[model samples]
Target: MNIEKARFNMIEQQIRPWNVLNQEVLDMLIVVKREDYFPAEQKSLAFFDTELPLPDGSKAMTPKLEARILEELALKKQETVLLIGAGNGYLAALLAYRARHVTVLESSSDLRDLAIGNLANNHVSNVDVVLADAFSFKHTGTYDAIVIAGGLEQVPEQLQKQLNTGGRLLAFVGQLPTLTAQLQTRTSGTDVSTRNLFETVVAPAVGAAPVSHFSL
Candidate 1:
């Protein structure tokens, strides 16, 4: 396969159609080599429109989904971001390119190690990878933005509390086949608002707060 041609096709056919129209984002996609983040055995599928498998029962979100989240976050050059789920560090590397600083939280040891190596290999220096369960992590200063790379049965209340007054967060909510990817913003006075970006399904974040045992 022609690597550049396939990448261009991925940007034009898969990502652009999903409303990733920002020239800056499109440019970053071109600069960041996705294949470098994939396992050698799966490098050929790096640009495919599906989640690439990872060891230890985890999966990377699809390329379009990664682009969509990046676009929706609308990261500013000086803004700091907190990313949940740093699988392979691909999205974190992408985020590092757009944001001033990124702190990524990953749960699995193997994935965390992979993330560090991949980010270094790409010469992405603005990201810090932490091995910890995202659902339980908290931030006192609040970040300019937060991104959950995987879906959750329901948004973690603690996670919501970590947002800065003007921060924005994007995550996939609900179950497979009908999940809605939502972007939420918190105002200066603490008013929160959300907009449904589009529907997409991703593997649920492991250890996300389980739903109530009995619902009304």
Candidate 2:
């Protein structure tokens, strides 16, 4: 397979058309080599416009979604980022390229280890992969940016509290039937502003707060 051609096609056909126009983000898509992070058997699906399944039953976001999230965060070179749901470390690898450092939280030990290994193989040294649940992990310091790699029924206050004033967060919120990708900014210690960027449904992160159902 012509790997370079496939990569280019992904950027032009899948990512760019989805409105991910930032030149830097488009460039990163080429530099990062998404195939490197996929399991050997699934490498063929790396450039396709679909979620790639991981060992722990989680799925990596599609190329367009990943690029869109990166564009929304607009990461800076000196920023510290907190990433929830480190599935296969592909997103963490992307974040690491744009941010000064990244701390990734993963509930599944198997996925955490896989993430560490994938990042290491790609020589991504700025990300720290941690085995911890996203909802319950206690952050030692606030972050300049935060991204939840999977969908959640709602954004948890615990995660929002970890964002520094002026920090930005990106996450997909809502149930399977409908979900919106929201960009939230911490305007002050107690105030946050949110804007919906797009609509898409992704599997909830493991251990995410469950959606309550009331049956009549």
Candidate 3:
């Protein structure tokens, strides 16, 4: 396949029309070699508007979904981010480019290793991939941005409590057949406002034990 052509088409067709118009987000989608992080058998689907299964039994967000979520987060060059799931590390790579640093929290050791290898191979050094459950992480400090890389009924209070002043948190909430993408901002030390971005269904996030029982 003509990789460049396919990437362009993905940006123009699947992502752009989905309203992911931020130039930086668009550039990251192109600059990050997404195929490198794909499960070998799913490399051909890297740019397609479909989810790819990851090593941990969780699925990577589709190209457009990743783009939309990235755009929603609106990361800054000097910000620090916490990503809840590491589906082969592709999303972390994209986030790392925009943020000063990214800490990817994954539950499965096997998936964590896959992400570590992929990030290292790609020279994405700004990300620290850790094998830890998102629900039980003992976070000591706040982050400028936080992203839940999979579906949950709602953004948990624990994650909400960690949002820094002026930080942003993005998540896909609700059960299957209907999930809403929400962007929440910390206006001050304890004030948060949420804006519903969109609705879509995605696989349960790896290690998101709190919402794993959700059924279709």
Candidate 4:
């Protein structure tokens, strides 16, 4: 398990083939060590093309899916991001590297602590991990971008409303056996455009209770 070699293989084989061709994103993926974000037991899966297990009963998103999400979001260096469901803080660290700042909302206290510690360990100082559930938590501040890192029946409109003008959001929408990764952009006031990225299944969020606002 040559770490650097495995990471290069992950980028060249797993992520690149998925259409994640963004150069800045690829570079950030290399700089931010995903392996460092996982626990010892999950470190082996760091560069694998699958989700790493966390103790909160939720899985970190797969490498390719995460890359694709970042690719689509196209984060600006000065943009602020809101990340829902921080898994071990890996994704938040990635977001922090690309964006000016990131605010993570996590329901699981353990996961929140893990995210805070991991981000600190990784030298990511632009992220704040808050112990809050996205399903019930209220977002008062708007963001330049938003990412829902877990599966949801449908993204609530309230969350969508939290997006600033020209903001982008990436999320895995739908339930088991069928889930689609979609990116939404706030084109204008109260109006959003959506694009379907890919299809995949992931575990539910901390307080997932799906409604029905998605059609892909």
- Number of the top candidate by lDDT? 2
lDDT of 2 by residue, 24-43 (tens): 99999889999999977888
C-alpha displacement of 93 in model 2, angstroms?
0.4
Q: Write the per-residue lDDT of candidate 1 for residues 1-216, one digit (tens) a residue.
A: 899999999999999999999999999999999999987888889989988788778888899988888888888999999998889999999999999999988889998999999999889999999888887655564788888877677677666677888789888887655678898888765577889889876777766854232334
lDDT tens digits, residues 1-216, model 3?
888999999999999999999988898877898899976677778989887776656778898988887898888899999998888888899999888999988888988999999999999999998888888778776899999987787778889888898999999887776788899999988889999999898777655644544475
Looking at model 3, residue 191 earns an lDDT score of: 87
- Model 4, range 1-216, lDDT digits (tens) per residue? 788999999999999999999998998888998899887877777999876678867677889887888888888899999998888888888888889999999888988988899888878899999888787886699999999877788888988899999999888887676689899999999799999888887776657686344546
lDDT of all predictions, in order shown? 0.85, 0.88, 0.86, 0.86
On lDDT, the stronger of 1 and 4 is 4
Whole-model lDDT, model 4: 0.86
Which candidate has the highest TM-score of all? 2
Q: What shift in Å separates residue 169 of candidate 3 from its native position after superposition?
A: 0.4
Candidate 3 regions exceeding 4 Å error are 207-216
Clashes of each: 0, 0, 0, 0
TM-score of 2: 0.95
Please give each candidate's TM-score. 0.93, 0.95, 0.94, 0.93
Residue 87 in model 1: shift from native, Å? Answer: 0.7
Residue 184 error for model 2, in Å?
0.6
Superposition TM-score, candidate 1 onto the true structure:
0.93
Cα RMSD (angstroms) for every candidate in the order listed:
2.1, 1.6, 2.0, 2.4
